[model samples]
Structure formats: structure tokens, C-alpha cells
Target: MRFPFFKQERRVEERPRDFRVISPRIIDILTHLKVQAEKLKRTYHRLLARDKELFEACVRAEQELDRDRATIYANEIAQLRKMSRTILKSQISLEKVIL
Candidate 1:
């Protein structure tokens, strides 16, 4: 899920040219991606903790077994990709400055 996002960010970061000199928008995008990636990382950590808590309760015979369809997570993953697609597809063309 987060793997593809991470991979795309890596590929973009690995570009042969340094756009820092020519495009601030690219830098901004990179920064935004880094922040979002961190957020996803934290979300994973929190979800893991939730799973662990559920497992502990289940082991103690206090938690009932309730399962959700896999599609729930799948849809969330798809939505994330859709958001990234929209973000990346946006263009910021430079305007000519009059002398």
C-alpha cells in the first residue's frame, strides 16, 4: 500500500537532473510527499498497535471476534493512490515576467 507511494517518491527523488535550480514547485512537491509519507508511516504504526491490543484482548477471552471485509482496507488504499495521482498530475507553469 504505502510501498508504491514510497517507490514513486524514490524514483522522483532519484531523477538525473537537479531541479532545485530551476523549479521550486518540484522541491515543494518533494517536501509535501515526505510529510505525507511520514503520516502514512505513523498511521501504520498506530494500526499495528491497534491490532496488538485487539489480539491481547482476544487472547484473554474478553474480545469477540468481529471481522471486516478486506475491501475496507483496499478502498482506503485505492483512495490514497487516487489522491496522489491528482496531486502529481497538477501542473504549475511559470508565468513570464515583464521587464
Candidate 2:
């Protein structure tokens, strides 16, 4: 004797796979990507503003003949520039994904 639980049954119907079913997920992913891109843009702009401020301070220090202070400010500006480059690259990549 065979058990009923041991028998395999085939599905009588299968739902059609179409764009309507997948559009929502695609939209959600694009929205997330856009948000991330905006964040990166904001961060990049903020870095630029800060870098400008540091550059001014460094110039002031140099005019005052303060080598150490100017050096420190210059180093910070360099680091900010590096961060900005990284953020810009990420933003570009996100834009490509969204497209």
C-alpha cells in the first residue's frame, strides 16, 4: 500500500510573468538609487564648501608666516579632495544603475 502524502501533484495553473509584476520592484530600486545619488551630491557639495574655507584659512596662515598651521590646513584640504573624488565616482555609478 502507498501513502497519499507520498504522491506528487503537478500545478494546474501558473501565473504569467510580465512587466506589470516586475515594474514596482524596478521603480523601488530606481528610487533608492536616486536617493543615494542625491545624498552623494550633497556630500560632494559640502566637501567643496569646506575645502574652500580651509583654503582661505591656509592662505591666511601663510600670509602670517605660520608654516605649521598652513601645513595642517593644506593637508586637511587634500583629504577632503580625496573624499570628494570618491563620492563623485560613487554618484556616477549610481546614476548609471538608475538609468
Candidate topping lDDT:
2
Number of clashing pairs per prediction, in order? 0, 0
Assess every candidate by TM-score. Answer: 0.43, 0.77
lDDT of 1 at 10: 42
Instruction: For residues 23-84, write the lDDT of model 2, one tens digit per residue.
Output: 77788887888888999999999999999999999999999999999999999999999999
* Alpha-carbon deviation at 5 in model 2, angstroms: 51
**Candidate 2 ranges with C-alpha deviation above 4 Å:** 1-22
Give the whole-model CA lDDT for all candidates, comma-separated: 0.49, 0.92
Give me the displacement of residue 95 in model 1, in angstroms.
Answer: 31
Runs in model 1 deviating more than 4 A are 1-22, 62-99
lDDT of 1 by residue, 18-95 (tens): 544758776677677666655655665565555555455444443333334334444554565555444433321111
